[model samples]
Target chain A: MATILVADDFHENRDVLCRMLRLVGHSTISAANGQEALDMAQEHRPDLILMDLSMPIVDGWKATAILKTTSDLRHIPIIAVTGHVTPDEINRAISAGCADYLAKPVDFERLLGKVASLLGDTQRPPFLSS
Target chain B: MKLSIRTKLLAALGLDLALMLILGSFALNQMSAMNEEATFVAAQTIPSIDTVNTINDILLSYRNLQVEYIINVASADKLRIEGEMHHLEEDMAKAFITYDHFQLDENERATFEQTRAGWEQFVTATHTQFIPSNRDSNTGNVHPSFSRLAPLYDNLLSHVRQIKQQSQQRATTALGRVRAAYDASRLVILSETTLTIVVSAVIGLTLSSNIARRIRKLRDATMAIAGGDLNQTVALRGSDELQLLANNFNLMVASLRQQHLLLAQRNTELSESLETQRKLMSDLVQRKQAEEAADRARATAEAASQAKSMFLATMSHELRTPLNAILGYVQLLHLEAQIRGNTDMLPDLERIRSAGKHLLTIISNILDFSKIEQGKMNLEIDTFEISSVANEVIGIFSPLAHSRGIDLTLICPPEIGLMRSDAGKVRQVLFNLLSNAVKFTERGHITLTISHEYHSGKAWIFFSVADTGIGINPEQMGRLFQAFSQVHHNTFHHYGGTGLGLALSRQLCQMLGGDITVESETGKGSVFSVCLPADIGTVQATRQTHVLHTNGNLPRHIPGSVPSLTPGEETAVVASPTSMTQRDA
Candidate 1:
């Protein structure tokens, strides 16, 4: 089990994403915006980040860029999530250092699958096993 | 007075002719006078002079004959000499008679009278004394008589010679008079001819120079005009033909000047008009350029509007973030409740989930409507059984139909097979129609009938939802598919919906190469029918329309062989009103 950071401008979205990550036996931390996500990521150096692209400040793409460029945090994978699901946005997010991309409302099963693939964990999450 | 050329010439000629006539008549009079004088000299003076000379010769011959008679001694000689003397005396007498008949001047007549008396004396003495004395041949009386005869003869001869001299002098005077007359006539003729010649020459010179000078002026003016000098004009002095010509030439020059001025004015006007046309052409070019610039501005504004529309539509989808959280939490809560075996909280969670999903559905409907508005909706085509889709839509509406005490039925033909279309959109259209039926109905049945048929040589699949519920009013039918148009404003609270479902459904149908139509009767029932091409790809290919990929994504089609649908145990009814209720209870 690896530690993951969930970033979103909406607290509920952050909370749910963290709760889902926790339920899958992964340790999760949450940030209310892109700026907090960046600060928290630098401080915690989590194994993965689920970054919400549209946020109050610094946005997911900027935070991802900052984290990916940093020597210590560059190894961490990022999964970009946003309600803006156009192909252009998906491409933009991936080009901004995201390991993968998902469109909101986030499908938990798909998210977990992408998370697992990006982390390279062979183990299935608890919710999917059930 | 006007001395016309004709009159001038005629007057000059007349003057010349009169002068010539005067000269001719004067010369003729002088010649006649001279001729008369010469005739007088020839006819009277010459003859008188000749007669006197003949008489003198006869007197001398008489003297000689008397001497001969006195000297001859022979009788024969005396007789012959006597006969000659006698003949001479008779000839003398006849000559004297002839001389008496001749004309003579007074001096000649006096002298002739003396000579005639002397000759008479001689003849008397000869006959009375000298002859008798001569007959007695040696008589002294004969000597005395002869001496007297000699003296008389000498005196007669002297008188005769005097007469001859007088006659000769008269003839000389006559001849001198003829010669003087001839000289006087020659002088008169020469002077008259010279005077006539001078007058005629003066008249001819005056008339010709006058006419020639005027004609020269006119010719000069004409030459000036021919050389393109329109300012030239002629003024002549005389009231002659040439002067009239000069006046006419002046008038012609004035007319030519007027024409020249008119031509210059026309040239100026033409140049001005040409300049004006050039200015107008430039103005047109400027106007056209301005119009093109305006067109380019309009195009830029349209592009900006499209971009803004895209952003807004994407933002609307983003608006569902909170709703997603609510649904997610509700599901988590329900899971928690099930784990705790708390059945009572499950219903509230389910209700919350339902409310959140409905909110999401409204937003999604708005998003879809906006996508249509932005011309950005894309079609995902796949082959799926039409009856199965109909049954699934019926299953979704069964609970609501059961709760409302309305029978929901799916009437689909078993042979209504697989269709290549946008299945998701078709499901959404059926859901909207069935939901509307369940929401509006009080007690009647909601039937969804699925069928497949050929239309215009192309396969079509139709989903018709007919409900025996509250019917739509005819007045509101025209606005039925208009976005945001709720036909029953008063029933808006009674029937809760976003009202965009039907509009979006119709748009979606149209996008799929089909259309949605409705029929209804007031206070009875309503029917909504959706007709779609069985193969959307074929329809798209045939029509070659701008139907998909507004966000620049290619239309996604499932890669698989089509599975045909048949009536078998594999086909199961998804829901019926009774079964749906029984399963729920």
Candidate 2:
């Protein structure tokens, strides 16, 4: 299992996404905002990050751009997560150094699949296969 | 002369009359002189000549009687001769007295005096000599004393002849004077008549030609005015009628020229005003056009502002409240419930999940309807099998239909091959119709029929949902597909729906180059059909034009609280397929 970061402004959304990642056999650390997410990433150096684009401070797009520019944290894959699902928003996310994009009311299965694929695991995670 | 035509004409006539009068008076004077000469020749000259001739004839008769006495032989003859000789002497004295009664000139009087003297001598000689001779004659045959009487008788006869010749000469001279006077008067009259004619002709010619020349000048001036030359003036020098006419014509021409100047000035002013009016008209037209353009720009800006507010409203109120935390927590709870093997709670969790999804669907409907209204919806065309879509739709409705105790069937031919269209919208339309069918029908069967066919060299796919349900009345059919309009308002509480499914479905079908139609019989069943082009790309080109035309006619503002769907709803829409898959799993 890999260490993952989940950032969201809503506590319930963060709690549910963290739970879903743990259920899928991945260990996840959570942040309530993009600034907290950056601090958590710098502290733990998580293998992956689930970035929520709309946040109170240091929005996901700025956080991703900052992390990608930093030498030490630039190698970590980031999957931008947000409620905004327009094509323009998705393109913006991808172009802002995000490894992938996911619209909210997040499908856990697709989220797990994208997480595993970015981590170089081809098979579906054990919780999803079960 | 400063004469009028009437005065000049009268003067010319008067001159002719005076000349004629002068000729008449002169002719009268000459005639009176001629008449006096003729009277002298007729009365005085002829009477004197006749009386002198009468005296000369008596002397000749006395000589003849004396010769008769000398030749007589009887005494009775001698006595008769003596009585005749005595009567002859008495008659000679009476002739002398008659000669003294005539008027005579100086030469005539001298000639008459000699004749009278000669007459008295003859009378004495006749008494003395002739009587003695007659008495001395004894024998009636011969008288020796008759010789003395012969010379005396001859001398008296010669004197009487001279007096008669002198009187005849005076009569000839008087006649000659009358003839010469007549010739002189005739010459005077003839010359006067000729002079009158020549002078009259000269005067008439001068007057008429002068009048005619002046009239011609006036006529030419009038013609010049008529020809548009206002500078003409008729100049005349006399005070005649023609000159007066010329002066009046000059006045008239001057008046015409003044009026012409006034009219020309008025025309220039009118034209200037017309030009100003035309410029004002053009300015007004341009201002009107500019105002219209400004109005159009304001309308566009207002539309954009309305769209932005609608998005914000939907995000703040409709989307963020229930969709973000509630649906996410519910899904987490559903997963947890299933993981914990809480069989009793699983149903309630599923109910909550379904209700959350239903709310999501309603929000999606509003968003889609707004996008369509704003001409923002675009087709995501793909090639997919109709059978699979039909099967999927049927599977979705089958459980609901079974729970409602209604038969659900799919009539899709195997030959219904791959169709090209917006698969998501197509599936959504089919889902909307099937869900409606399941919600409305109590017990009767519902059938979904899918077919593809060639229509005039173009491929078309038709999806029809026939439901035995509470059929709609004819009057409600008109507004059936209108957004937010529900036909069965009385049963709205009993049958819950947002009334946007049919409207959204019809709009989605049209965006895919298709249409939706419904046929129903009251209290029996309803059949809703959707027809779409197999290859939506071909019609998408034309559909864009249709969308723009609709956009032009759209109202400036769309009313209602379900204003627009925000990005939150878009996420729900994007997550829908996965949600369905998970629900099926």
User: For all candidates, what are the clash counts?
Assistant: 0, 2
- Count of backbone collisions within predicted model 2: 2
RMSD of candidates 1 onward, in order: 11.6, 14.9
Instruction: State, as a TM-score between 0 and 1, how close model 2 is to the true structure.
Output: 0.59
Query: CAPRI verdict on model 2?
Result: incorrect
What would the TM-score be for candidate 1 when compared with the true structure? 0.55
Please tell me what DockQ candidate 2 reaches: 0.22
Interface RMSD of each: 1.5, 3.3
TM-score of chain A of each: 0.94, 0.95
Q: Which candidate is the best by lDDT?
A: 2
- All DockQ scores: 0.41, 0.22
Specify the highest-TM-score model's number.
2
Per-residue lDDT for B395-480 in model 2, tens only? 98888889877778888888888988878889999999888877777776778877665565677787877777767778877767
